[model samples]
Target chain A: MRALFAFIAGGLFGSGLFISGMTDTAKVQGWLDVFGAWDPTLAFVMGGAMIPMAIAWIIRARRDTPVLGGTFPPPAPREIDRKLIIGSVLFGAGWGLAGLCPGPSLASLSYGGIGHWVFFVAMLGGMLVAPRLSIRLDRTVPAE
Target chain B: MVMDWVWGLVGGLLIGLGGAVYLLANGRIMGASGIIGGLVDGTGRRDAVERVAFLAGVFLLPVLLYPLYTSIDTHITGNWGVLIAAGLLVGIGTRIANGCTSGHGVCGMSRLAPRGFIATVAYILAGGLGVVLFRHVLGVI
Candidate 1:
């Protein structure tokens, strides 16, 4: 049941990317153009996402237990440490350069979008390597 | 921009609503990263059927929607090699960050998670800088 819920959610998220013009790298790149050809579409897309999310969260918050039978999973760690900063930078860079972030990239792949596949494969590789690198570094270097 | 916004609103609402319903029915955050991660990390059945269907919706929906609106025309000017390199880097970033834009940006930020907040900010900044540095400054744009 939890898996079913997750599946539905994932689909909606991907659908959002498809409609938002986010799947188009050119559109994304246009937003980055500040001086000459700036596009504020991304901002609006974000707003569109935020408004509905706010409403849904309010309803969910009132619930004691989610349908799957447990309390809401606690948020991941909240620290704004070095790892957070570096990881974000890398993610953003990839998004900018490839014009594909995780959400849209995967969604795009469903259509056999060439770019999406490229991004998806690499993203998976990165996910696998991150923990290994962190553990290795943890053992090799003293904690600050 | 207006067109994109309309699409975004419709898309977001549908996704959010669908996600909420799923949450209400089950009890999971509809985060793509977590689902995919589970699929890849040995929890195959957890995401195999549902996630696959969800992904199919993502790709096919555009084709369905295009008829009702302006068609999306994508022209890639970058070399495949460069795009692939960037993708690999992004993959790593998503893992280190513990979620992707969908997980952190859409779902995480909605819950007001501090980590999601920071991660989203980083995502925007990095993406913005990447465009300027590579596309604009470097003439790729």
Candidate 2:
């Protein structure tokens, strides 16, 4: 039952990504192109997405457990650490360069061509290797 | 212009609805990177079945809907080198940072989490700077 809801949710999210042009790399790049022909469509998308999610968060605050009986996700991590900043910077660079993030990238798999495939494969490789790399980095530098 | 905003708003609402469903039904946040990231990193093994089910829905439903709509355009870049490089960066970055646009930007902000706001700001600023460097200064597209 929970899995079914997850599937439905994923489908809804994918459809939304496709409908809103979020799956389009050009559209995403355009939004990032502050100096070029800027497109504000994504801003509207973000605004639209936040509305119901905000409500959901509010509803969640009042409940001890979700409708399916599992404990809700813990509070968001509050640390503003080096890993957060550096990783985000790198992620932003990649997003700007390719105009593809995980959500849209996954949703685009159906029709995405060779470029998408390369990106997805490489992204997976990076994901696979990141933990080890972080572990090494942590050992060398030590967290402050 | 008007149509763009309308479509964006509608689509965003749908995305939010998906997040809401996941939160309500599974007691989890609908963060794509974290969901998939955990599977790859082995931290999400306990919830593997649910994650796979969600991914199947994300991947397969779009294929099913493609024929009916036939209008969605994904302008992914053709440069293999750039694609691979960008992919690597995204994978590493999102993993190290622990979220992405959907995770931190939409879900996190909606819940008024400080980390979400910080991550969002960091990525947006960095993304904008990346655009300036790649598209403008470097001309690397």
Candidate 3:
């Protein structure tokens, strides 16, 4: 039951990305291009998404466990470490360069062509290497 | 003009609805990066089936809906070097930071979490700066 709901949620999310023009890298890049012919479509998308999500969180506050019987996710992380800032900056640069984030990147895989595959593969490689790199970084820099 | 906004709103609502569904039913945040990242890192190993099911939904829905929507043009960079670099950054950055647009932008901010807000601002600002530097200044992408 939980898995089914997850599947449905994924489908809905993907459908939204497809319908919102978010699956189009050009559209995404256009929104990011503030100095150029900027498109405000993504803002509406973000706003629209926030409404129901905000409501969900409110409901969450009242409930201890979900309908399917699991503890709610823990509170959001609060620490503002170097990894957070640097990673965000790097992610943003990549987002600017390619305009493909994980959600859309996964959703568009079927029709994404060669370029999409390249990004996906490399992204996977990077994810694979990150843990090891972080371990090394941890060894170099004492725990905070 | 108005139609684009409408589409965006409708789409955004669906995305939000999806997040709500996951939260209400499974007691999990529907951040794509975290969902997929956990699977890769073995952090979400206990919930592998759920995550796989979720991803299958994400991937397969478009296949079924392909007929309804207009053909999508990704406009992803063709340059291999740029693509690889961008992919690596996105992967490492999202992993190290523990969130991305969906996790921080939508899920985090919705809950009024400070980390979410900060990460969102940082990424958006970095994205804007990157656009200015790469698109306007470097002219490479």
- Considering only chain A, what is the TM-score of each predicted structure? 0.83, 0.94, 0.93
Cand. 2: chain B TM-score: 0.94
- Best candidate according to DockQ: 2
TM per prediction: 0.85, 0.96, 0.96
Docking tier of model 2: it is high
Q: Report lDDT per candidate.
A: 0.68, 0.88, 0.87
lDDT of 3 by residue, B43-99 (tens): 889999999999998899888888886656678888999889988988988887778
Q: Tell me the tens digit of each residue's lDDT in model 3 across A1-144.
A: 988999999999999887887878877888889899898888998999999999999999899899999799988777777777777877888888898888888998987788988988888887888787666656776655
* Candidate 3 lDDT for residue B69: 60
Write one digit per residue (lDDT tens) for candidate 2, span A33-131. Answer: 999989999999999899989999999999999998879999988877777777888899999999999998898987977788889889989999999
Judging by lDDT against the true structure, name the best candidate. 2
The pairs that clash in candidate 3 are: none
Could you give candidate 2's per-residue lDDT for residues B95-128 as a string of tens digits? 9888999999999999988888888899888888
